[model samples]
Target: MTRYKMEEVLPLLEERVRRYTHNESTSVTYEKARQLMESLLYCLEEGENGNGMDIMAGEGDVKTAFTLGLARKKEKIKLAEELFEKIRKDFHSYHNHGYEETVMKGMPAFFLRYDIEFDGKNHLLTLDYPLFLEIEELTGIDLIYAYLKAARIEQDFLKHFPTLSVEEILRGFNGKYEEAYFNISEIVLYKALGCIMVKRPAGGLFMTEEDIMMLSKQLQERSKEELESKLQDALLSLDKELHLQSEVSEYFMTGLPKIVSNFLYYKKIKKVFLLFPKRKQKMKLQQKFQDGRVMEDEALRILIEKMQACESLEDRLYMVKENVRSLRDLKEILKECFWGDEFIQVFSLLSQEEVMVLKKEMKGRIAFGKGCIYKYLIKI
Candidate 1:
């Protein structure tokens, strides 16, 4: 798929080698040329992802493309530095070595000492902290970008609750969790899903021996597709509380399938799934909320939580209007809104006639097919 030929590439690379060596008399080994070529390709690929230039489609000459790519690599390095700062500013760590070292030590050193022009392919850090999901195929700046994106998403989700609650979950997950390698998002997210499997609130993060039995029985009864849907629902339900942007929601959806397949085997919640939220450390129940409010009804609770987080009434409607692209989305969100303040806060902007229309539709739905989500939505 390369637009430029090997013959076309060689002269430019030779010039680069001459410049790199600082003299024409300096020797260029065959292995040295190969490594430089790799660095060349890394820079060229960086053209689009790092800067939005399409070098592969003959936008410019190969030499021009390489120059543009070097600029893009420098820009990407600067960006990663900025992102690390924002993430660590209000950040709550789960107090683990791998996570701390990668963010505080590993990434800082890379920013200061990275040689972008000569060694674009050099990964300056080991990136030891495991992600909830990862793109293993990527290298160089591309991999660093993806890793930071995942870390940002995890931080957004984890910050909703108190730090000690999360610490409690990690400790329950393992007393020596700090010493071991663990994905913070992996533990928090799966524990939330496990709460769903046992008919507990994903927020509470608790499960007993009987609850484990119930979860096992439910797994037996559900098909692969059904289980996957439920897991996705757990995340979406959390999204209701968090009101994550569309792209952030898409990020989670893209990574879910691979992890779901691993969970399908389900032999005792991955050897020791029982290490759930002990909920014993009663410092402050970090219920997911903005103001001092909590709701028990799942659909109403999460939807209202999202709507309430909005600063003004206009933004609240816009958040829902912009994101809900299908009838399925509309029905799912509306059906979950209860017949109280939870519903009122979300529809505060709706006209009286529009409210009447919704009232009729909901009445018909309640009469015809009353789903579990509609249980909290009493007859109007």
Candidate 2:
């Protein structure tokens, strides 16, 4: 016999049932259908052998019970079909709106397909055991009971696989499986919303430019602290209502990236300030650029010239370094006007090639010392 306990097997069964019933067409008689589904779910929850048959009955008797249970389930399904048809007819005019469409069409079909794919596959395969365990704990049911019960019939199979090893389980059986299912459905919903927002009239999901501008202005008027407070309150409300984590890191790492990328375009920050450096050490080279010791006129001109020539933020930073290296080489001739440490610090952040370019520019500037600084810098 497999060492796998009833607690271990229960969650798989519950998840299967959850998926199966997710988008099930609930009727005007949904209460009746829900009860029937619950009873089936309850059987899985209480354990298939909850009637004390596992202990009291022989192996042959257990098989008989299993066979009978399956028969009884089929009859219940037939009754459910009848009731579903009635409900469908009654609610014939009821269109599946945003929420209903997601639950009914997306989740239900996905579950049915999942169960079918999983039926003959080995039970031990799992993508993430922890996530599966979490789902099991939440639902309070076994997910693999049906397959396990079937596996029990073959003594050799049971002997060979006495226990369901977490590693042996298919990864698809875990909650990650459900996450993928939900993610796909969410993508579809987002696309639909996008269509409404872009193609539909202002009265529909889309609003006029004036309305958008007004909303933007209103939001801008709010103090940063007030906005942050409101955002926190909104997240807390969502956490309570949805029973999910509301942390920024979790949101950014998981579903948020996909959602945000779909709707908004973001600019990359070229210059990054290390707010939290691991170590703080002052370099000796920084002393040279301190004050009015070096001529600011030529240095300023070189910096501005390079900045203007570069098309992008990255290019501009590159030019800063090129100017620095050239100045470093002419250290002998321009000892009185040696490049300062402040300039070096800024240059260090740039690429090596940019440093080379700066070196060349500095050499030219020093050689032609009489050039108009403001005009040359502005032209660059």
Candidate 3:
């Protein structure tokens, strides 16, 4: 039982990633094996209960041994080793202070909130709670949601701002356009041959005389219908940038780093929960998380009905067991349903019986194998 260094693990990880990237198999086996090895690395560093050797022997022996064999005798081992070194460097570098606070080894708040300033001016718009929650779950980045929430709040405030006349806006640009029209919220200056032209937001957008002049000249030749179409596209783009997770942070780039941080955050969270292993505490945290992301009641009811509509009891049981976390949790949900008290009681009783049946099925399988029997006997 020897402790392995990061260098020792690099060859194994590289080989797995090489096969995965080359599409050696349609399955995700190599990727999963790589993740397993990475988890062992984390355990080795953290030494939660004991050294990596102990944890690998007690919990991860089978998978680690199998993946080590897969890494053996790889033809592209040199290339894989180079790739692994790059990955290792990038993973370490991405842990900036903000990333460390929000996603890496930190349990970020489910909701991100912050104030926003546009063109050095603050807007009164605020993100609605439901939309904030939606964004939170969508990006899976709590800090990004804060910025989006601020922008949305400002957007709502902008709805009340007086719309400047197109002529007045164009006057500063020194453009000759008499019959120009643009709503402040849905601003677009022109269209060309049924093609809508969009204005770029530069130097604080709508705040500059130059922007107005440029927009005025663009709209001077367009028919009202074409102008209207372009305006629609511009407004949609603005709304999307504000409401969706287009870009939340100026401090970080938008792609791979954010993705990698999010992946690492969840892995860290799982490791933390596993270390503590307190069922009640875990349940409470999970409940809070699920409340923000869970399906609506009507949707849940429809799903339950669909499961009930399955042809056989076994099908229904399997579906419920797979989808639902526990019998007790399902029972509580049924109690809150508007369907009826009788339905709730019946569901509770039937679900408990099904759970027992499923347990007995597992026990029956255990009876057929000595290794399974040994495991079960130790559990009791």
- Pairs of residues at least 3 apart in sequence or in different chains that clash in candidate 1: none
TM-score of each: 0.67, 0.20, 0.16
Better of 2 and 3 by lDDT: 3
Poorest 10 consecutive residues by lDDT, candidate 1: 283-292
Please give, for residues 1-380, the per-residue lDDT of candidate 1 as tens digits: 34568887787787778877886655678887777777887776555344455655546777877778788778777888788888878766677988889877787787777766667787788898888787688778767877887888888877654455466678767777777887877777677667755655555454554666567666656677887887788778766655766656677778789656756766335443443433333222122111223223575456657865654433554555444433334455555433222343333323344445455566656532454323322321
Expressed as tens digits, the lDDT of each residue in 1-380 for candidate 3 is 23555576666555545554584654456546655454334323333233333544565543364334223312223333343333333332111233233222222232212111000011122222222122332211222334334324323433222122222222322232222221211121111111112233311122222333344455444454554454445434544443423332221122224323332443444431111111111012233323334455676677677765664433443444345554434543433321321231123223334434434544545332322322322221
Evaluate model 3: give its TM-score. 0.16
Question: After superposition, which runs of candidate 2 have C-alpha atoms over 4 Å from their true positions?
Answer: 1-52, 55-63, 90-380
* Local accuracy of candidate 2 as per-residue lDDT tens digits, 44-113: 3233444533633333332344344444444443443344334333221112132234323433343344
C-alpha lDDT of residue 248 in model 2 = 25
What's the number of clashes in each of the models? 0, 32, 5
Best by TM-score: 1
Best by lDDT: 1
Candidate 3 has an lDDT of: 0.33
